[model samples]
Target: MNDTAHALGASRTLWELAERRAALTPDRPVLLQGDRSLSFGELRERAERVAAGLYGMGVRPGTVVAWQLPTRIETALLSFALVRLGAVQSPVIPFYRDHEVGFALRESRAEFFAVPGTWRGFDFAAMARRLGAKGVFEAYDGEGLPDGDPAVLPPPPAEGTSVRWIYWTSGTTSDPKGVLHTDRSLIAGGSCLAHALHLSPDDVGSIAFPYAHIGGPDYTVMLLLYGFPAVMFEQFALPDALEEYRRHGVTVAGGSTAFYSMFLAEQRRRPGGKLIPTLRLLAGGGAPKPPELYHSVVREMGVQLTHGYGMTEVPMITMGSPDDSAENLASTEGRPPEGMEIRIVDGEVRLRGEAVCQGYLDPAQTEEAFDENGFLVTGDLGRLTADGHLVLTGRLKDVIIRKGENISAKEIEDLLHRHPAVQDVAVIGLPDEERGERVCAVAEQAPGTAALTLAAVTAYLRAEGLSVHKLPEQLEVVDALPRNDTLRKVLKYKLRERYSGTVK
Candidate 1:
């Protein structure tokens, strides 16, 4: 391996450090999924077996291997195994249907696939086989596969050699885009995240987010780099997660607003209840977190609530550090971590840093995403505070122009979420003949709560002293809000699809 300091610019790649840690803590638990646990040595052995298996299958360096598996021990092992073999991984959420899976496969040009036969009552093998026939690689069965002899592969030629992963965007906006990340970028991002969270070898991180997302992968890499143990949960159930946190002594965890809400609901169900005491930090991102949820997490759980703002193209651009003020933690996505630069132009957020992805796989997209100056123009609309923190206003495309006023949909949605009966809310702009465009709010009411009328919503906005133009002219109550895998982010584009022209 290259010099640890040089490979990471100042540190080592997570896999590189993991090998050293495995030798140091061979019998220590490195991964836990349900009742099954794998020690560091066992995990390394299994990864070597998987690497040998891939070698036997004729997979070589630079090959793309797509994986769609739950957050199981094998999933973690296989992911590292692909890295050990110098292959790039493209992880897709297990919940992705055929259409989504096919889109990712096509975008990444994946040549090999790894999937579970069955997980959480779903038949992934059958589902995968059907999709594999359409062009993707055939799914390999992890359970019945033989453990081949251990074999070591050459390390990457050098830092930033070639692409290490092709991570797909969350697709909350339009079609999913593939973002290429080199080993240098991945190591930098992981180190930044680990430093931001103040993670150490004794820390045990419990991840509720899907492994397919950037947040999950970054968290995993951070923990492994620090030689910390991580607890992976396949499904997101608040009570079960709480039990796991308490059982595993999990120190750090992260999820979306929906997860915090579920955890809050569970806490209310018990007498004088609270989240596990071992949880030192609770982080939420991928969407705007309600102030009430933030307050509750800090008040009830005795843990700080933090939020991060980033995209797949630039993961962990800004996050609230553990030392940040409570108001900073609650009000904005804290300043950029070390070795990163962020700026605001015409209300659009732009980024430039070592942690930024190389570029999109599509040449056109790569050209479009970055400007001539090489700064990535994030489609997000936000402003940098005087203190350098980022306050997200709304998405640039989601801006509502009614008459002549530019209305921020996120501002209105944040107001609506504060309503007593509103459990979740999303704001979008719909076509309007006279006004140019009108503001619309789609909300999901709390359980057993009565539906809200447009007039009532308008009255609430007026009572809160919001400007007339900021009030949503139209409101729709639905059983549930359409969200991406994290369940924290609202798919406003989908809302636009359903109600863009239907609004009166």
Candidate 2:
């Protein structure tokens, strides 16, 4: 870690870190979107003003605010403003719809809700109203954001260990669990990421994913720690977003395995040419990276590809450093930073660290998530290398990660069961080179019903309000889904083994 950053990392809260960074690098750009930029100084100053504006609206410390906005500069500002007020924040991914969003709002009991109005033809404001959300407000642009004098703002939070964040992650079943976190935990996570990447102020980063995701604060903390700027993409589609990346001279980029594949696909379009002339490193987590994909990025794109392992519970646990060996970089998920302990108990990965979340929102869920040793029981199955790198084998949870987003198998299965043509269904994640994992639905047709097609299944899921990303990419009709003779439970592993490479 940089000596200056290490010293700044000792700050008690995210607001303190932002204030410290602003004091040191007031003029330095911290966030870039299109032709506009927010400097470290401006981030603190504007956030305070926004905080005062929020306070005038009855928001106060400990208020639960839920925001489902895109990856935009205004979104970052709104989030930091909430942090400034010491309010508990719950950010929902923009891709999530009525099912997930409604559940998040209801579970979080958010006192205030922020949306992007009619974003990309979707009426999020209307959806919020439909969900009967409290204090619904549109936060689409700077002009629409509430503004007031910073002088009216209260003192920034001094304590950092109090749980102030609620991040949602798909669980073993249909409902998403709210993973609790504190400011200190998030700081530790960002420090691990910033230190592992060994980023300098000269480096420019890019955030292509939804800022509402856990990676939002994770990435923002890196900027505050390193005093660097990152380009924000609200609607990140390939080829179109590339121009902005090149325009900003992004040196570090990559959101997940899917992002890597997208960049590689663009690079292949112009063989023997640099995808982004200034690009030097590709780094991300939240999805699996095939070893071959790593080698391909290094060989073809001429950039260092360092993958990591993280989740909503612990934003960053292990991350591959740029100085690591190619073999280690290609295979392992990298090494944990100081204070992060990784234990493999009974072939399952358990974590004990400052970055680990406090617990889930539900008390019983919290009790069940931790062990006697107090280590967070990560459902992932992995082992540590002799040298400290982590190599994940598989996951014990019934969740599919397609393009870095988790899709609950039971959620989709429950919806699929409603289809009249489906008698029984088993949803399994099949390995894919590009997406890391593809959602594949295998079904046994209902009596007197014909075989189901992927089109019909997807259409049904869409009508059921399932997100676009969770729709099954492949559909298979079998005489019977492989089930155990003991309790007649669907054998998902057998399905995975049978169809691992069978689907395209």
Q: Would you estimate the TM-scores of all the predictions?
A: 0.91, 0.81
Give the clash count for model 1.
Answer: 0
TM-score of candidate 1 relative to the true fold: 0.91
Off by over 4 Å in 1: 1-12, 120-123, 127-129, 132-146, 152-160, 172-174, 448-451
lDDT string for model 2 (1-504, tens) is 789989988989999999999999999999999889999999988888889889999899999999988888889889999999999999988878899899999999999999999988999998988899999888877587888987887888889999999998843235889999999999999999999999999999998887877888999999988999999988777899989988999999998876786798688788978999999999998865667678878999999999999988999999999999999998889999999999999988999999999999999999999999999998887889899999986667677889999777756876776687875677899999999999999988876776699999999999989999999999889997764221123567788989997855
Candidate 1, clashing residue pairs? none
Clashes of each: 0, 0
Q: Would you give me the overall lDDT of model 2?
A: 0.88
**Residue 19 in candidate 2, Cα distance off native in Å:** 0.2
